[model samples]
Each structure stands twice: as C-alpha cells, then as structure tokens.
Target chain A: EAGVVQSPRYKIIEKKQPVAFWCNPISGHNTLYWYLQNLGQGPELLIRYENEEAVDDSQLPKDRFSAERLKGVDSTLKIQPAELGDSAVYLCASSRTVYNEQFFGPGTRLTVL
Target chain B: SQQGEEDPQALSIQEGENATMNCSYKTSINNLQWYRQNSGRGLVHLILIRSNEREKHSGRLRVTLDTSKKSSSLLITASRAADTASYFCATDSGATNKLIFGTGTLLAVQP
Candidate 1:
C-alpha cells in the first residue's frame, strides 16, 4: 500500500503572503496529524484529526494557522500572512488508530523570506 | 514545549559498531516510541514499548523502557552506514494520546 502523500514537497513564499500545504493519508487510516519542525529540533504537533473531526488542535496558532479535513481522507493546512518565523518543515502523518504507529509523509519545506 | 529530551545531541560511529541513545521524559506515559528520520526526510517508526513492558526487540533494534525512571534507551547493534540518521523518542501521554517528541539525536555511521 502506498504511504501518506503530501503535495508541493518544497515551497517558498515571502512574508505577509499566504501559503497552503496538502496531505493525503494512507488508505483506511482513520487518524491524521499535522506537525511543524524547525531546524535542529523535533516535530511539534499543530493539529490532529480523527476522521473529519479535529480532535486535537490546541497547539495550532489560530491567529494565522488553520487546518481542515473535509472528507476525512485529505487535509489542508494553511497559513495566512506568513511570517519569517514560519519557515520550517510542515509534516503530515496518518495512523490506523489514535494509539497506533504513525506513517509520515515527505513533508513540505516552506521558506518564508 | 517538548516533554522528552534526548541525551548526546550527536554521535558518530563506524560500521559494525554498536550505538546507544537515551531519552528522558517528564510525565507519566502510556507508551514510548522511537523513530528514525533521514536527512531532509520524514520520520519512520522504529519501535514502541509500553509502560507495562520492559524491553522489546525488532531485528537489529532493541528498545528498553524504565517507566519508574521515566526514561528509555534505544540500542542498534552492528550498525551500518545506512543507519546514519536522526533518532527521536516520542512519549504517548495525556488523554489526547498525542505524541510529544524529543529533540532527537543525530547519528552518523561511517562505512
């Protein structure tokens, strides 16, 4: 089976611009997650979805960051008025269940100048 | 805030040698998992050990969890150059079951 897939493996945007990342989870997976990773650091959870409901998104920056999984299979994370500090890798992952092993996508490397 | 912290930010080893990395977390956890990420790539799950379990092995990887000490260690035996990557430990804690990752340890294996 194919693993989780993410679009636009790399993206470059200027500050104050808008940027979006897309993700397609593995077949039959019921949970999806979005994470932000900075240089020399591990990934931090931004949002998590169980089916079409965002079960955990307390860490997401509501002022600028938003994510949605309309059909429960694909998800999109958007950052509006991007800032210089927003430059980092945006990763998406999927799992069979909430407590199961997660499969990750090759992440979109976003650079905000 | 990261709940786990990995010791030795970086390590270098030669092929056929063994590598061990440690992780310490601050909260009570249901399970702890280890993952490997190649340079510029996504993470790949390595092993998972439950709080009730002590040690588990998969192929060349051995993971041990000490819930009492709130720490865990990963051992890769007879390492290969292909094992050159960053290793992370994530704790599954809280009611959300969200994984809180550690700062990761970069390992370089020389062939």
Candidate 2:
C-alpha cells in the first residue's frame, strides 16, 4: 500500500502571499494530522482530524493558518498572507485510528521570501 | 512546551558499530515511538514501546523505555551508511491524539 501522498514537494512565495499544501492520506486511515517542522527542530502538531471532524486544532494559528480534512481522507493546509517565519516543512500523517502508529508523507517545503 | 529533548544531538560512527540515542520527556505518556527521516524526506516509523513495556526489538533496532525516568533510548546495532538520517522520539499524551516529539538525533554512519 502507498504511504501518505502530498503535492508540491516544495514551494516558494513572497511574504503576504497565500500558499496551500495538499495531503492524501493512506487508504482506510481514519485519523489525519498536519504538522509544522522548522529547521533543526522536530515537527509540531497543527491540527488533527478524526474522519471529517477536526477533533484537535488548538495549536493552529487561526489568524493565518487553516486546515480541513474533507471526507476524512484528503486534507489541505492554507496559510494566508504568509510570513517569513512561516518558512518550513508542512507534514501530513495518518493512522487507522487514534491508537495506531502514523504514516507520514514527503512534506511540502515552503520558503517565504 | 509539549516537545521532548534528545541527547547527543549528533552521532557519527563507523559501519558495523552501535549507535545509541536517548530521549527525555516531561509528562506521563501511554506510549513512546521512534521515527527516522532521511535528509529532506518524510519520517518513517521505527518502533513503538508502550509504558507498560520496558524493551522492544525489531530487526537491528532495539528500543528501551523507562517510564519511571520519563526517558527512552534507541540503539541501532551494526549500523550502516544507509542508516544516516535523523532519529526522533515521540511521546503520546494519552489524553489527546497529539504526539510530543523530541529535538531529534542526527546519525551519520560512515561506510
């Protein structure tokens, strides 16, 4: 089976521009997650979805960042009016359930200039 | 912060040698997992050890968890150049679906 799939492996945009990343989780996976990873640091959770419901998203920056997992399979994370500090890798992962090990996708590397 | 800290930020060793990395977390957890990520690539799950378990082995990877100490260690025996990557430990909060990840250990095995 294929692992999680993400589009636009890398992206470059200027500050104040909007950018979005897409993710397609593994088949049959019911739990999805979006994470932000900075240079020399580990990934930090942005949001999580159990099916179509976003069960946890307290870490997400509501003012600029938004994420949605539609039909509990595909997800999109968008950053509007992006900032230089938002340059980092955005990762998507999925699991069969909340208790299972997650499978990650090759993240989208955003470079805000 | 919910993130954990890893010891020996970097490791370089000859092929066939053993490489050990440690991770320390601050909260009680239901389980701990290890992940490996090649340069510029996504992370892959390595191993998972529950709080009730102390040691678990998969192939050449051996993971030991010390819930009492709130720490875990991952040992890769007979390492190879292909093992060059970053290793991270993640702790499950047990209450939420979130995982607190450690800073990560950069391992470079020379062939």
Candidate 3:
C-alpha cells in the first residue's frame, strides 16, 4: 500500500496571493492531520479530521486559512491572502485510529515572498 | 500548542556509537511517539509507546516512557551517518486526535 501523498512538493507565491496544498492519506486510515513546520522547529498541528468531519481546528488560522476533508479520504489546505509568516512546510499525516501512530507525506514547501 | 520539550538541542556522535535523547511533556497523554525529519521535509514515525507500557523497541530504536514523571527517552544504538536528522517527540493529548510536538533534537552522526 502507498503512503500518504502530497502535491506540489514545492510552491512559491507572493504575499497576499492564494495558495493551496493537497494531501491524500493512506487507505483505511480514518484520522487525518495538517501541520506547519518552521525552521528548526517541530510540526505544529493546524487541523485534524476524523473521517469527513473536522474535529479540531483550534490551531488553524480561521481568518486566512481554511481546510476541507471533502470525502475524508483526501484533504486540501488553502491560505488566502497569504502572509510572509506562512512560508513553511505543510505536512499531512494519517493514522488508523485516534491517538495511534501516524504516517506522514513528503509535505509542500511553501515560500511566500 | 506545544506539549513536550526535548533536551540537548543538538547532538553529535561518531558512527557505531549510541545516541540518546530525552523529552518531557506536560499533561497526561494516551501515547507518546517519536519521529524523524530530514531537513524540513515530512516526518517519519519511529516508534510509539503507550501510557501503560514502559518500553518498546524496533530495529535500532528503543523508546521508554515513564508516566510517573511524564517523560520519555529515545535511544538509537549503533548509529550511522544516515541517522543524521532532527528527532521529535509528540503526544496525543485531547480528544481531537491532535498531536502536540516538542522542539526537537538535531542528531549528527559522524562516519
């Protein structure tokens, strides 16, 4: 079976522009997560999805960032009017159950100039 | 929010030596997991230790969790240059399935 997959491993856009990243979790995994990783720092949870419902999005920047897990199998994270601070690696991961070990994707490296 | 803190912001060791990193977390956790990240790319899950379990091993990796102290340790035996990377410890805290991660420890193995 394939591991989690992410698109556009590298992305560059100007500040105030819109950027989107895509992720496809592993098959049969019910829990999906999005995280932002800054230089020399660990990944921080942006949002979490349990199937089609987003159970937690407290860490997400609701004003400029929005995410969807349409069918729960795949998810997309969009940042409108992106800011310079948004330049970081966006990682997607999935697990078979809540609190279980997670598998991660290569991640989308976004550079906002 | 960040939940755990890893000590020894950086570690340098010769190949074939052992590397050990420690992590301390706040609040109770159902499980603790260790992950490795190369550069700024994605993270690879190394091992997971449940709250009830004290230790776990996989290949060259060994993880020990002590709920009494709310701390965990990861030991990599017979390390190789390929082991150079950033290691992190994460915890499952709330009911949202969200994982809180620590600052991380950078390990550089000299061949």
Q: State candidate 2's TM-score.
A: 0.98
Pairs that collide in candidate 1 are none
Q: Write model 1 residue lDDT over A8-73, tens digit each, in one string.
A: 999999999999999999999999999999998999999999999999999999999999999989
lDDT value, candidate 2, whole model: 0.93
What C-alpha lDDT do the candidate models reach, one value each? 0.95, 0.93, 0.92
Give residue B10's error in model 3 in angstroms.
0.6
What is model 2's DockQ versus the real complex? 0.76
DockQ of each: 0.82, 0.76, 0.73
Q: Candidate 1: lDDT over CA atoms?
A: 0.95
On DockQ, the candidate that comes out on top is 1
Q: What digit string (tens of lDDT, one per residue) describes model 2 on residues A3-107?
A: 899989999999999999999999999999999999988999999999999999999999999988767789999999899999999999999998899999999
**Ten residues in sequence with the least summed lDDT for candidate 1 chain B:** B39-48
Instruction: For residues B40-73, write the lDDT of model 3, one tens digit per residue.
Output: 5558988888889999999999999999999999
Candidate 3 lDDT tens digits, A59-113: 9999999999998799999999999999999999999987567899999999999
Whole-model alpha-carbon lDDT for candidate 3: 0.92
TM-score of chain B of 1: 0.96
- lDDT per residue (tens digit) for residues B45-94 in model 2: 99999999999999999999998899999999999999999999999979
Stretches of candidate 2 exceeding 4 Å from the true structure: none
Total clashing residue pairs per candidate? 0, 0, 0
